[model samples]
Target: MASKGLATKRRQESGRRKGKEDGDKTRGGGGDEMKAGGGSSWAWKTKTENAKKVEALREIEQLEQKINNLDREKGVHLYNKRSDFRKLFCTLEEQELKLNSDRKTEKAKLRQQLNKMRGSVTKFQRELHNVKPTPEFVEKLKEIMETIESVVSEFKEQQKQIYEELLREEQTLNQEVTALEKRLESWASAPPITIETKSVKPKTVSSARNVIADLPPEVAAFERFLLQTGGHRGGWDEYDHGTFLRIRNKFKGKSAFLDEAATSIPGRNITDVRQHENWYQEYLTLMEKKKDGIQKWKIVKEAQKDECLTQAAVDEDEKKEEEEQKTRARARRLEEERREQADRLNAWKVQKELMKAKEEEKQIEIEMRRAKEYEKERLRQLEVRNQVQEYLQRKQEEDAIQRLEVESKKAVQEEEKKTMSREERVRFLERDQRRLEERLAKGKAKEEEQRKKSKRLERLKGQVEVQVERDPSRLYRLTEGWKERKKDTTSASNGPVLHMPHRAVPSWRAGL
Candidate 1:
């Protein structure tokens, strides 16, 4: 039984062992299958991660390709733009350089022009510097310039006269026009059969008289001379004087235009001139008196100082006298009046010198004006003479041309008359030739005479212009001076007319 049990146990154990093996194998295989499934899941996760990475890589590659395409397309355009900017910069730099160069050139030219003008001024000054004037020279120069000024003034007067004539003409024309217009209006307003008689404007009569009643004797005499000889102006007939008098009559009373023109210079009246001179003389006299007073005061003060200096004398009597004298002369106030007078004198002297310098300058200016006028006159005369000569030459040439033509015509006619045996000739040819020659000769002589007359007229006109421009009165020429101390032998020539020395009402300051 023990033996049988052992065999069964062995078999059971063997079977058990076989079953365990089979189970082990099955478990191992199942475990292996599970592990394999787990590995597959892990691999699937890895594959998902790898797939995402691959997709990301593909996107990166596409992006890279796009970028490359953009770079290729844009690179050329950017390079071309940079090249254009570089060229433009260089061109701008060149233009800026050219402008700077041009500016420098212009500045140099302007500098040169300025330098040339300065040089001309210097030269003119140098030339004038060497010509020192003599004492008489200044006087002569003044005379000449004054003459020139006079001539200029005369021309203006003539121009004024011409203008006045024009005004008269214009007035006449307006009157005629007004008359014509009125006639037309009357014709238009009247009945068709009725003749209209237009009324004439009344002739205006001026109640004013020539204000020459208060004229000085000299002025009166000059007026008489003017009336008697018709001004004796070259080429001006007696009729011209009548014309002048008519024009002059128009401005009998004070006119604003004439007054303003006359008073352009400050205090520009004859009376003012005399007053200024008197004032200056009085000022000089006062200064002299002040100087003399100062001198006297200085002497007195010196005497007082000497007395003070002697106050320290030793002798008893002298000391007593010195003390008494020192008491009278106080050192602090001793020379006060003298010092005051001295200062006043110095101030006065400075003013006097200034006034003197001003007077001298005025005189100098007058002289220069006259000199310039004289030169101008001389030049004018030369020009006039040249013009006359030129005219005469031209006239002679015309006459010669006419004469030659006449001679040629005559010779031709004479030659042609051979055919007719001198039986007939053209009428009026010889008479006409003679008349033309006479006309030419007369014209030449008249031209020369007119030239001379023009000069005299110009000179007279110059005098009138200056006198009138200064005062616009006949009295401005010193023609009515009544202050002259008359001598019995005073001639009735071109001199100032004096009135009886009664009393002159003092003149008032202007703009008072």
Candidate 2:
């Protein structure tokens, strides 16, 4: 018995080992060996290091896969992706926010440059309001834009003509170059044609604009001044010799190409070719105006020095820039007023049309509602008509049933009457009483049958329905139910039902 038990235990152990092997093979590779010290149970140090290395490598691979899947160019998480729900939603919302200060400044600088060229101070300043510029700053900006506009307006037509002239010159030069190349080829055996590469210089709309852009922002304000005044370095390069010499004498130590050009000249008169045009004169005037404005601004600051700009009231020196602001504001106000006036006229016209349309729509709606109501009433009337028809059908069925009962009872009585004289009938009834009783019973039962049928219909129609036993065998079992019922109903015999009681007649009528 002990040997058999041992044998059984051995078999169970062997089966468990086989099952474990199958399960291990089915599940996966033995990667957990790495987690268990890289399968190096013998050496502690190597086991730890190898396991750490494997884990690090796996983490790096996962991160690389993630990075590759993501689009880095957009620099934000993709909302459409499902990889990481919370992180992606937050990142997308952050990216959708408006620009900060650095971006604001960049955009402002770009707009200032564009508007300087475009020459629309009113539009530019309105746009600039978001920049939180001071009243003084805004006024200065308008002044500068005005000057730039004046310069461009003066030179725009001339510049167009200059562009045309340059185009013609370019065409002539090209023709000359072609002709010379042909001649040179022909004259290879002869004397070479001395055609220098006479490339026509193109006319440029070179702006003091770019100068402001190029200048280190340490002197950015001055550069801005130059831009505003349309005073290109090229223009200043064409200054008079005497002024050039004087500037050289004053700023002897400055080490800029512009400074050198302005200061030093050879035998030629730099300004003789192109003196200060209205633009240069305007530049000087602009400088003076800027100086005056700055001085006044300083004075205003001084007056408000003890009394703060914000913590105190307005002072007299700020009055001028303020007046300029009011004037510009008034101009914009008038322009806006004109626009509003036109808008009002348009609004009035639209309102009249809308009113007319609304009136028409109201009438149409009212008519539609009335029509729908009329149609609904007609439908209700139709439903009532159908209900009346159903009632009439039910009444007709009841009347037919009543008539059938009356006719059947009358026939039974008449059949009995034809049998014999009353004394003979009585004698004959005594003999055939059981058969007559059955006939009367059946006839009486039929009367009760209708009443029972009506009661069943009322019960069935009135109550919530419950399913009934509907097997054919069950139905067959009830096949003779009506006949059986009829047999039980009548106690009629040859004795006079001489005056059928009212209660019996009523029950008869009810059955029918």
Candidate 3:
């Protein structure tokens, strides 16, 4: 019985070794080898544990294959999604480009319209500047000119009548002078007629008939002196003759003239008369009377001649002055007429210029108003364009921020996958998802805050624009304030901004 038991035990040990070898092969050797070197009971327990370990390793390998397949599928899906996102982004870019191009075209059309309006306004202004006066004012001026011409014609007719009358009078005077000259010539040429008559005793003519020839020598000499001293045609009057007679009477008793007479007479012998002092005195007195009378008559004649010449000169001067005055009056009237015509022409020109100026001013005012409206519209267009540009810039910034966040999350996921087991990796993914959610929430909150700030800024900008429109004087101040607020907001949030997945910033906020 002992021999039979030993053989059976050896057989059992061989079977156990064979099973250990199989288990080692299945468990990749180490655990099964340690169990094979141990006791029987421990070996049985190790075999079972090795079997379970082998099963678990097979299951793990199958699961790894599945995980690898899933990872490849996930990679393909992510690649396809990335491609779709790229295509979608390209499409959006194309659409945005098209929209921008359309906007540019619209802006150009608007500018063309504005330019055309400005050109029309300028043309209208030019036409206004060249405007003419109304026909009614021209007709009124023509009537005034016609009235002035009629008055001038009437004055010329009256002057011509006066000239004709003077010409007739001159002709009559010339004819009378000619007739008188002919009569005198005929009388001078008449033949002398001799008449025969009987001789008769002639009566002595009265001394007064030949008064000049019958006068005494001294008186004759005095009379000759008076005639020589007198003006042409015996200019001395009765008053002058009386003055000469009175002077002669005062010297009548003097005899100084007798001595002079004795020397002057050719055959006179007055020695005895010269010896008589009384007779000498009387003769001298008579001679002195004659001299005095001659001198007095000469003085009176000269004075009368001077008075007559003065009167004649005065009359001539007055006549000449009257003629000059008439000439001056005619010249003045002609000058006045010329001045009036010039004034009328200048007034017409001034009125025409004033009318043109008024028209130009009206046109200028219209042009200014149109220009102001155009400027306001242009400014509004510019503001819209600026808002669009700002919106585009902000969108670009948000897109860039989202791309950066996605890339960072992908890097973190790659790192977690590299370091963690599946379950740990899953926990890490969940944690990351949670963190991402929190970050997204925070980003959303920040975006909301930024949106609110932008909205506030927009409100402020609108208020500033309203103020600027209402009272342009405050434009500078409001603009400065807006700029300052914008700077403050920008400075306060100067850090990097993260974007959320769902929410989008408004275009107006981009403006802020």
Clashes of each: 18, 2, 12
Q: What tens-digit string does per-residue lDDT give for candidate 3 at 385-471?
A: 999999999999999999999999889867865665566557679989999999999999999999999999998887775533467
The runs of at least 3 residues in candidate 1 whose Cα sits more than 4 Å from the true structure, single-residue gaps closed, are 1-334, 375-383, 415-512
lDDT of each: 0.52, 0.53, 0.56
Assess candidate 1 and give its TM-score to the true structure.
0.19
Which candidate has the top score in lDDT? 3
**lDDT agreement of model 3 with the native:** 0.56
RMSD (Å) of each candidate, 1 decimal: 70.8, 39.7, 64.8
- How much is 417 displaced in model 1, in angstroms? 5.7
**Per-residue lDDT of candidate 1, residues 137-251 (tens digit):** 5665566556555654664576467457655544444433443453345345533331111243533332112222222333333333433322233123345334433433555
Decreasing lDDT order of the candidates: 3, 2, 1
lDDT of 2 at 302: 61
Please give the range of 10 consecutive residues that has the lowest summed lDDT in model 1: 206-215
In model 3, where do residues sit more than 4 Å from their true spots? 1-311, 314-321, 324-328, 331-335, 338-342, 345-349, 352-377, 383-390, 393-401, 404-408, 417-512
Cα-based lDDT at residue 12, candidate 3: 38
